[model samples]
Target: MTTATPQKIRQLVDKLELEAALAIMATVEHPTAEIDYLHGFSLLQVKRDLPRALELLRRSEKAGFAPFWVKYMQAMCLSNLGRRQEALVALSSALGIDGQHVGALNLARLWSLELLREHLPAETTNILKTLERLIPIQTATAPAAKATGAAVRADTNSDAITTDDALMMALLGNPRLFAAPLVPSSGVSGAGIGGTISAGHAQPARHPGLVAVSERLMGRRLTVLDLACGKGGVVLDFLLRGHRAAGLEGNPTYQQRPEGHWLALADHLHLVDLGAMTTGFGEDRFDLVIAWDLLNKAPAATADRLLRLVSEQLLAPDGLLLAWAPPGADDDGDPDGWIRLVPPTGLCRRRPPVTPAELPVLPGLVPVFHSRPEAIPLVQHPHRPVRVVRGRNGLPALREEHRDDLPRVAVISVPKAGTYLVGHLLKTLGYIDSGAHAGMGGFDDYRDLSPAEAKQGGPHLARHIGLSELTRLLHGGQFLVGHIPCTFANRRDLDGFQKLLLLRDLRDAVVSHMRFMADAGRAAGQDWVDIPHGPDRLLRYLQSTGRIYMQMVAGVRPWLDVPDMLTVRFETLMGDQGERQAAATIRALSTHIGLQKPPAWNRIRHQVLGQPTKTWSGQRSRRDGLWTAEVENAFAALGGVELNVAMGYSA
Candidate 1:
């Protein structure tokens, strides 16, 4: 075999003669690390054997052929392979090692821009392009340079773009565009390349801020009201998550369009000018009120008003606002001084730039909190009628003032003994977590509404929010779930409130709790030593689980003793749901809530049963004995068997 130096082989490869370069490579008997690097580049060039190419790159690095270009090539190949996250890692690593490697920095900059551009709609993209061109290109007018914008890249004397990363914003003249996410959302696949940008599934992945919102509330489905929701994608995402979400689009074109999201969301989308808004739903209603698109372009004063409206009337006390500021808002931000956040992690931000900007607007995913976010009321115009589109698959759409006549109901589960079963069950009885009918998710916790009240009044005191006190807050169709115990002082606290108490086999609860800890252990670092497990780790888990859940289990009797408390068993709810005990439980709920009769189960049973959530266990207790003798002993030691007896489980 012929011996060819890397320089000789590289000459051919540089000429785009990859086949000849590969033929020369095959002739080498014992290749140097440089030759191996060249060989790997040849493979990547020909779009053949990407894995082997990566292996060769690794070998090159390990065999004293380490160079910054090695990582640059690897990042390129990884990005081409659709492993963008891995590509980012390699690029970041390269930057960490060689900060001035222009290739790696350029690639990262380009990738960030692509991610930002891909998420925005064509209209938005066009607007950005127009703004970008606002600042003229100060390149040469030479014939060759005039043919292309290469003069800027070729020019060494030009200092228009600095190293600090103000490149895009400098050329584009808007910090808002650079405010987009530099990376994809860490844990949200709510939308895709062709879905929602700000709110719906009709665009791309959301703006980084919205993606953060989705990731923050990843699995917990809460009521979402997307203001100025475009194409209803975000609303649709919340709806699919089983939250009763609605969207207010002042423009009717989203409905006028032939997009598929309109079908399921036709009943939920409303045409309105929020300047003069009014609905029967009371204050502190929604878990999230997204003003991403609405407040994004609004002036500072207008944005403040809108933020105030959301904080006061729309947002749940425990809820969050996924906010964004207009680029110009930086000019006169907080003009009216009404912007506030309970906590400000929810502020939107652009991802940090690997390249330092000349004039950095936002470098990392650091949020741009221009003014002190405090709370303000935003009033806007026009109430619109409900318009259900024609193509739904027989899904009912309601126009009543958001179920205001429905009773204020409270659901309390004794730890993991019960799942979110009764909450969904009560939905079958005209309860509204979001809309008029039973939805996929709900029983909005009343505590979330009165956080200050709950904190000041203590646990049981919130449920004591007597009937007259709750009349306006409940607004008829409210359903809340909490962990309030039936105490001596507050046993009568729930007198006017329709109460539900969920119970389970203490043995099964212990087993589930143990399984949860073990599962958690797999991902946890050494810091999760809170659970003390011994040589027989399984047995220790069982004992530990029983001890941990014992307090909640011990408090179950007071709920059972309260005759007004509608006690529902987890086993009965999950097992033969049609069995006598289950039927009796259902009857008790209906009678306790003052419903005329039980609902037709088969018709709405699927909706009531509810789907598995993030916390749902594949090994969730099905029958009995999900625990052991050790666990039973631990429960007995904690005096928790009373709940098992009251729930009618054989001890």
Candidate 2:
């Protein structure tokens, strides 16, 4: 084979007269120039001629050269050019065509904050969540510019930690936008992200005035209530002081504590809802009501209701109300005027009394002694008010910071009687060190999460796990248990790649679900029909129930097999062996995860079973005549037929 010489090639090119040949070759229309220009634009991008490249890409696109990567790169060029809004539009268009394009996802997550700063100022949460979704399915290798709103990429294991921290900081630091900060209740000194934040050396209060006030309040079996107990800081203070403590907070994450028998701890601490209490439980229930500095949180109406509730329900017979106003609250002439506690009688005496905010504003409320202990200092000094509530002003500024070097254990569960009981037992039995449940996730839900799914949804509730608590556990080695919905969103936490696919007798499950839902009032607008027994509302029932099941099963597959899962029949769960097996299983799980069972678990279980003829459902139980039939049909209709057969279903 002979190679053509340059002179011969030139002679051939001259003979062809390529440009003139092309002009003569196609008198008809053709997209040759547009295609050539697109090729050129790609080369320019490779050569770093971003502006010219982008312009060419725009021209190509205008000429109908449709390609996914081209648009995606154009967006990248726009972003590099600081045209964030334009970049977002280009990326959005690219994503609309291909939702999971990594380049677009990276761009979205990397520039989310910057894009947000440029566009919708109010939808910050939406933007952050969007970025949270785009976090590489792969682990990060190194920390990137979190402060500058750039995507942080670190090693996979470390990335989990870094991503979690950045999310927490963003939410907490920017409270104006991210209204809900991910905060956990308490821990065995380790469990979730908040625990990690508490891991550092304790900072003694530099404010001598604040220290004195804290110490003075340590007097007596003080019944203390911490309002809006984020990360349980004040609650921990009460525990340290050996005082009777309780906390009131609206955030669901706080109730999802990592400590074993967490609620038992609450009972021990004397925490109760003063507004929602049984009659004859106790009169003049509390000794002190402390509504710390949480005034400027939300709707003013809601704030006033909280304030008034504290004044009435939480105050003791001769109790004192401790309130703190930020420095900004004192802008009006009277320093004491910032906080005015008026008695019910005093309020009534006023000519047309002013309406109090919050709820159940008592008419007889009256203001008591008002004092300003100028000596107190805050954690972070602002020109703001020193928020501290105590009876004394003389004490040490700092106390020793205590760190608990415990293993990490998470127990997942949806809201159910046995779920909480199991969580209690795990802690008490010394099987698990720490656990949390918002009663949101379903039981046995975490047994099927894949690495990909875990990364996607983990941070949504990552704060529930104390980063400090997990300090000792290996990355990916730390344990988590949850009852989150087995839906597409939470399947990330499932074990392996698939669920164990547990099957219970459909009739029995329906009965149990009915009883459970009635007790919980979880599903909205579910009322019984008027009949001797009852008309079956099985459709709505199965819709919600099956929806959750399908979501879970769909999310976990190929990576995990059904054998790795466990499906306890509802009847079995309540049977004689049920409690024993459940208890034993919890014990086994704790041992597997490295944790101690809480001592209170057994006691709680015993108390639960000891009650005779357990009328647990009471008036809520609506007998359903067709429940069994409807459930049977539903099981056959859904993917449960095979499962039912696998579980040895005959009918």
Candidate 3:
């Protein structure tokens, strides 16, 4: 009746010892859902025993183990057995559980297209159409010959020209489009169009002007179209508020399931060609057209055509177009209104500019509101504009400052070294309330600023009052956080700034970072999954061109010898043994920051040490000798041992 852990079974499976794995599973008197799933998966994939795998999978499902992966595996088994209908059904069920399951969606699109084409609801027909365009079926003679022929025909039909036609035409027109290209869309996932930057990257708190605009348009009887909608967060927001909203993405890889059944069935989401100068939507079709981050992708010729199309064809006579210029759009000095485009080859080309002033004279459209909103101060484009004809200009400034008597403190740490923990601790101690600004290491503001601008007071210091104004702004309570390397180049900016540098064991830090990158890459459908995981890969990463591990060590090395910098080890504030040390560190930090009254160390300890925030990739064992001998040898070879010892770790 003894049971083996899933990890042990997984290890056996990893080693290709399928028989041993099965034997271990057989020992479990009452095999749990997980055990059944692992056994079934191994049998199906490794042993290729389809019937037995199906039986075990069904049992696993019966035993309450019906996750999306289990369902997907079942569908795969059915497909391999030539049970098309059952496979399609299982895949559909998997999609129902999680619509964006990439593998399931890809399989369904490839094998179950006929079923989807015939059975998809009328409102969801566009989904099938989009899939058809992205993944064309191959013929014996040519893989995409049929699609290419259709595209040529579609392009010739100028009256009924679609986004697809425009894309085809562009590709056909420019023989060298892909050759020596600048700003090429390499390594970018097509899971969604214009997916260059994720919607999550847009911090609403940092850009309240956008939120305000959304709030103002809420409950309006407008038909909205979001061009190049990456992830469709804005469209979803509009839909949630009962507005008619649709998103057009240019990337073929982007796929998402709307939360509501109605939203999913509405066929509001479309996959379109952003590179195309014109979308087939009729003139005066949309009451509101939003092109949040679309312009940068288009070249000069294309941008001009797109603007003309937007002005003359897309917007209703009385409708509004909300557009924001990209980071460096205004710097292009072409008097004829041309802007520079950065292509994939790292070369720049002049393109027709889409400026704010042109909106006023664009046929029927007229500018209503235009301003460089305070929220977007970091934008490099000098003439960055937020223009709306029918919309109001009443959005409150996004930036807010609070002044208090408490001394300002900056908690700096190596990336992935429990920065969040220290920040949360400081927040809990009341050194700074919610009103206090907690930047990502203090360099959050400098991220968009140029190196020269950053050197000259940095973004926050320059944009706001200079260092002299820091006393007024950060009087009673001010805390900053940053991971910027402490080097001679940045010494001027760090001068007069009080800092606490946090460190962790180099070996653990590198492992944590690698796993994090892998997890994040997989979630974003990036190529990080192809990179092998383990000691060899870890060593390769340390020795890679970036030399990230060396940089990390060097970043903290300079600060170690500084008189005023308080150095704290991550291990000291982690786990049961470190609870007392955590309390002491907090006390020391409070004293350093000149807090009026020392915080309740017991309460702070309970909040931070007693219940630490779980690491994003799950907790790793803190036991010594976790690193393999090869990894240790590589670390030594890479000079990590010296850095580790200098950073207070025993060699």
Candidate 4:
């Protein structure tokens, strides 16, 4: 069989002709190791045959194909296979051998930032910074439309190319490779992977602020009305998320769909003068009313009337009023004045748009204020948005002026502890989401550590948060989250950050651990974690796993004593006494961090607590007392009771 060129296969892949690509793979009979590496890499996009793909990548490595490509793709496979810890370790190793490979770094930047959070390991950070420094592509109009037509290319070079099947295959896989402007000169950048994008491939995202806000509020469906929205920019943001969002633009130009501008959302855009809105215009009260710069533009009295009106009628009790503040003589003649009717409970600030949305009426980045239970004084909410599959770790910071007044906080807790509950309080208190969540940054990642690695524990907070990353996190308005056992290394690493340690009752912790493990195991297709039946097998499982359970019960001890750390018990923030204790905890936390207590605690609590976090599997059996007698007796027999007492929990 004639060894097919990579260009032909890539053309097929680009045109969505999978069978032809597979046929090219079928023709490889006595392939070299490099071809095998290429073959394995291409299979990564295939879903069911991943195990075989992994096997080939390993085989390629053993056959001396290339240490860098083999290990790098292996890390990608591991992550996709739901083995993130192994993937991180594998990536760290591969990066060591890469020696600042530019193409490799560019390919892996999004994944690295996604998995590691903003403060990455020192090695990954260096590579990504290099990628960030690269010049963006010149234009999107690459002349590579049919560039991968290797199959029908003149046969003069066939004899020479036939000798290096791998090289031909590599080029065959790059669709835009033949386009001079599209392909960079550094040939070996994505040698085996076959996928590469210059910085300018896609257009910049429009209305990132709106995108961010959509993602943050994506936890639930809500009706949002953005007043004075030109061309209905906010509609597209919520449109993708299935939220019903519309614009009330008084400008007839926008309402009628101006000649040059898009009227894509003309149906959703209502031609109503917001300045004259004294009574209800929309029949249903909105869950979120985005009065973008409406209040700021009106006179003080008119603004106050609009504020009282939005609060008293237009807004649902739990609705948010995102309004800009009027220029005030109220704050002793300060320009950035507060709203006179009701103070804002929660505030949001976002960086200005780099390329503002089309007909952007302060689209998402207008830096408007967010109000709960009333009209918002003009402030800013960084329209923070993230993709479901793509993580949002390296998002730009809130502008200095907006963030200076907010608080910086860190919470380190055990798995299944009250992570989201505290996160809820922090969000309500005006802390921006730093794109870190306990779902990924927890002991869950630690479970993959080999016994030797686990025993030789070092700084376990995201494995090692760099000093520079920690410094930026110190800026007010954002909070950090991680689940780690207290360690000397962690204590040293978290030295400058304000730390809060959260723990749950050991008995509840142990029970939640079991259920979580079983549920997670099933979700990951690890059927072996399920015990077959009855007491004897369960006893065998316990004998092997009992130590891990005890560790969850007790691992948070040293965390309690970190210098000036505010120790918050998970039970205190949830369960029967949750309302009373949570209020107290928030007050204590605000005082400890020296930030103003965010108002409307009940409303924030209702919105936050009512939503289920990503990690929430079901009604937590903790409140139901699932393993009370049996687990307690066994734990008592194992001396966990003493440890529980030390943590100030009941015996």
Residues 32-57, candidate 4, lDDT per residue (tens digit)?
A: 67656666666775654777778778
- The RMSD of every model to the true structure, in order and in angstroms, is 25.4, 23.6, 25.9, 23.8
lDDT of 1 by residue, 1-651 (tens): 444466778787767688898898888888888878888888887888898888777667545365556765677677778765456545655554465544444565556455435544564554344322322232434232010011123222121122222222222223332211111112212212222223423222223234223322321334567776766655644443223466665554555554424432344666555544433144225555665544544554556556666655665533456544334433343422123332232333222211222111221221232211322111111112233322122322221223423355767666665534565566567775422111111111222233233223211221212222222243335565544434321232233356788777766665565555455442133222344543234345434333325444543445675545677777777655555666666777787775776775555667756454323455565325334566456557655675577667776
Backbone clashes in model 1? 35
Two-way lDDT contest, 1 vs 4, winner = 4
Deviation in Å, model 1, residue 534 alpha carbon: 13
Q: What is the TM-score of each candidate against the true structure?
A: 0.32, 0.28, 0.34, 0.34
Task: Give residue 237's error in model 1 in angstroms.
Answer: 47
lDDT of 2 at 495: 20
Candidate 3: stretches off by over 4 Å: 1-403, 433-442, 445-476, 488-492, 522-528, 531-533, 575-578, 610-626
> Which of candidates 1 and 2 is the stronger one according to lDDT?
1
Between candidates 3 and 4, name the one with more favorable TM-score.
3
Best by lDDT: 3
| lDDT digits (tens) for residues 500-550 of candidate 2 | 222345444445555554444433343331112333555545544553342
- The list of candidate 2 runs beyond 4 A from truth reads 1-406, 413-418, 430-482, 485-506, 527-540, 543-587, 595-631, 642-651
Mark the regions of model 1 whose C-alpha exceeds 4 Å error after superposition.
1-404, 434-472, 516-538, 542-545, 577-581, 622-626
**What would the TM-score be for candidate 4 when compared with the true structure?**
0.34
What Cα-based lDDT does every candidate model obtain? 0.47, 0.36, 0.48, 0.48
Report the Cα lDDT for residue 454, model 2. Answer: 29
